[model samples]
Target: MDTYTTTIAVASIVTSGITISIGVIGPALSEGRSVATALSSLAQQPDASTTITRTLFVGLAMIESLAIYCFVVSMILIFANPFWNHAIA
Candidate 1:
């Protein structure tokens, strides 16, 4: 209700929005590009399909983790925010 709470509330909302947008967009774009490249490579080399497929899965998982981390951080900021106590006082 006070300035402190107002500031924290606004900041948390903005941060969460930015975090989710960047987190989702970056991974989405990366995954799309990775898939495109992998498909192109597979089309060029049918014999290496198995190896390429395995590597693509691993890379996708790794890329996905980045987005997951961002989601976690944003959730923390929005739900379990450390600054909430200060703002409440």
Candidate 2:
């Protein structure tokens, strides 16, 4: 393959790798920390368990969206990259 093609391929691979690592690791850490906090709160105030649990779910969803966004961006970069056409031409 031409240099342009090789370069694009290498770039895409690197981008995907970085995306996966950051996307997975960051969310995992955030979710773990959030759960730990929620559990601690629930233990301290058992009466507020319902509210705490509800809020925890919402926060977790929001945090997870970041990972989802990262996944989408990586997929776009790998499969539907705007630069691919330019490089090929």
Candidate 3:
């Protein structure tokens, strides 16, 4: 491939790696914090375990969506890269 195409591929790979790392790390930390807070709250209000569990699940799902989005982006970069065609053409 030409230099331009190589550059595009390299840049896309680097950017995708960084983006995936950032997306995963932020959500992982947030999930950890959420779980900690939820546990503490449950400890304080043992009777409200049901509500706390429900809210925790919701928060976890939201956090997991970020990771899923990052995975999608990474997969796109690896398999269905648009920049490859744009750069080569």
Per-residue C-alpha lDDT of model 2 across residues 1-89, encoded as one tens digit per residue: 49998899889989998998889899999999999999999999999999999999999999999999999999998999999888887
Candidate 1 TM-score, C-alpha based: 0.92
Candidate 1: stretches off by over 4 Å = none
After superposition, which runs of candidate 3 have C-alpha atoms over 4 Å from their true positions? none
lDDT assessment of candidate 1? 0.95
Model 2 clash tally, residue pairs: 0
State each candidate's clash count: 0, 0, 0
Angstrom error of the Cα, residue 21, model 1: value is: 0.9
Clashing pairs in 2: none
Candidate 3 lDDT, tens digit per residue, 1-89?
58988888788789889989998999999999999999999999999999999999998998999999998998898778887877777
Please give the CA lDDT of all the candidate structures.
0.95, 0.93, 0.91
Estimate the lDDT of model 3: 0.91
Among the numbered candidates, top lDDT falls to 1
| Candidate 2 Cα misplacement greater than 4 A, ranges | none
Residue 65 displacement (Å), model 3: 0.3
Model 1 residue pairs with clashes: none
